[model samples]
Target: MSLEKLPPLLALVCLAVPGTALAVKPGGTLYIKAKNTHLKASSSPTADTLVVLQPGKEVTYDSREGKTPWYKVTVPVDKKGPVQGFVYQANLSVSPPSLEVTSKSPDKPLSPEAFASSGAAVKALGPGAIAYGKTLSRPDSVQQLIALESLAASIDTAQVAEYARAGGLPEVVGRPQVARRSPAKKKGGK
Candidate 1:
């Protein structure tokens, strides 16, 4: 009201002005990476959802300054004014969701034939099937069974193919000689 009060009031206004100006940094862009993402009232997940942000909609948000970091975002409503809330940083990304580069498999899935058992497999079962082949009486048979199991594990498809070729055995079910698929011919060209 008076000149003395005016200086104090002006000093208070000057101190308050810079803090308010620096508080809200109003412009930055980010995209929602997942569907069903919520703009929450706080950083907590249980906080009320202000809006259901769709996958591709653009949103404007302010950068927050506090111990618990959150993005204070604004999303446009249909006819009403924009809704404002915070969103967790995890659900947001700089770019729209693209197909993520996945770690490639070193090889194709193993065929069932890869672990197919040979004659050794049958003998491995013999010791476990009968009571006469107990440990005290038939240690050799038990050892033989363990040996058979080891042999069975080592017997892969390539080994079977080699055995079949050497023993003059008939071709196994999986290995069939079929013609390779040829590319389709174009209508006007070869």
Candidate 2:
């Protein structure tokens, strides 16, 4: 078609801007449901820890770009810039976590342990909690505790291997490196 016959929008679209444009926008919100989740530098668990996210933190999800079960999340450390990192999708929930703290009514008089908050649960089942757990004779509670422990251990091992493979971190951190001996020093620092 002749230039004059072209629609105004079409004419503008024909301009040779000589550049490419890409759009990036947050897709959805994901909540961290498990304690001690790491926001890794990449899509693997072994990636450097960009941030250690506590349970109940909300993050913006952009994409599920990798083969591994990881999500791209944006977290802000400061006003300077947002940190883009990957987190295992297993511990993530599509809905924001609703952690019940306690009864809103003071007159209700809740028990000391009535309302088990997420933070409390995290601390309660922490590494040191095993001793306390062993002392309990409650069958149901014991089973649940065992389940949680197994889940946590499996997740930890899988993440570590993923991070080691993708993040370029050594499987074992802080290993000693043998010093490389320099060939016989030529007379006085040749």
Candidate 3:
């Protein structure tokens, strides 16, 4: 066809296309139903506390920022009763897949008391505390505590290990070893 005819055809096609010329804004409203009464949303998935809600409750939210680009939601406690409100995020799934914790070598002996003590400490102190203690504790317990904390961090080591085995953390491989490098060589190199 001639260029003149092609221009008219192109213009018609552009007009017919929906939301093509006008870019759709990044934001949109979302409505969610509470799958579990205990479910709540947070500003962050890693938040220490959660906002609680009753089952089948609904909430609306918008994005905090484009980067985090998720709706923030809070469930009011006692829909018609007296209770404080709790917060949650939209599009965040409360349920995570299960994971299994297994040792590298099953035959290797483990200290139940030490493991128990470390676990208790981990529970009481949380992930940050356990990570700090891992540095100060003996090598054996440090390894054990790191493993335990990994389980606490997600579902279990088996799950996290899958990511690690898939080559997720190349940056962290030499982290501990870098510290143990010769002080003289380290200073000179730097």
Candidate 4:
């Protein structure tokens, strides 16, 4: 192309550059804090998952921007080199998580069953909650709340995901963005 055309082409390229989606520079390293958190394609929780990251896995990340609760990260996958994606900020930590140990053995990590059975994992309703429940008209409400709490505590993440899938919920069971609804108009009113 002629020099005159080249200048305009370069100007157009520069103008389009900032608007295009591009990966950010590595800001720091972070470790996965959860057992099976996903590296998603976008910042949204329901976005496509690039990979499932395990607890304590190290990943390179870009600094968080604005009020967003997602971090852009590059995770090293087996045989696939490094893959860039967004992970929930809550799932990442600046330092690796120390494995929870059983009371009997300080060196060994606590098994899932052991943790579930431990006193630390099971918490009864506090006196305040019980008192509040007493104020409610339904005398059996407290017992129902206790039952519901027990049921929720017993269900694991895997079980919840499976239940969602079986019930025809969204394929990606990760936290979904809250949709905003427009205000309803009154009859004959614009």
lDDT of 1 by residue, 51-91 (tens): 55545556676776365647777777458677667766655
What Cα-based lDDT does every candidate model obtain?
A: 0.54, 0.58, 0.39, 0.68
Candidate 3: lDDT over CA atoms? 0.39
- Per residue, candidate 3 scores C-alpha lDDT tens digits across 11-75 of 78988995465442223322332222222233332232233333234443333434553444443
Kindly list the per-residue Cα lDDT of model 4 for residues 1-190, writing each as its tens digit.
4668888887789788762434334666788876567777778756666677666788998756467988888888778478787888778776677656866677777544345456555667878998899898996888888899898889777776668668976333342222221123112545
Instruction: After superposing candidate 1 on the true structure, give the runs of residues whose Cα lies further than 4 Å from its correct spot.
Output: 1-25, 99-190
The weakest ten consecutive residues by lDDT in model 2 span: 173-182
Off by over 4 Å in 3: 1-29, 33-42, 53-55, 79-190
| Candidate with better TM-score, 1 vs 2 | 2
Q: Residues 1-190, candidate 2, lDDT per residue (tens digit)?
A: 4556567666566554422232224576677765556676677544566566655677888888656688788876467677677778766776545535443644554322333432334433554566666677863675687787777756554465457657765333211221221223222543
Error of 3 at 74 (Å): 3.9
> How do these models rank on lDDT, best leading?
4, 2, 1, 3
TM-score quality measure for candidate 3 = 0.24
Clashes of 3: 6
Worst 10 residues of 4 by lDDT: 177-186
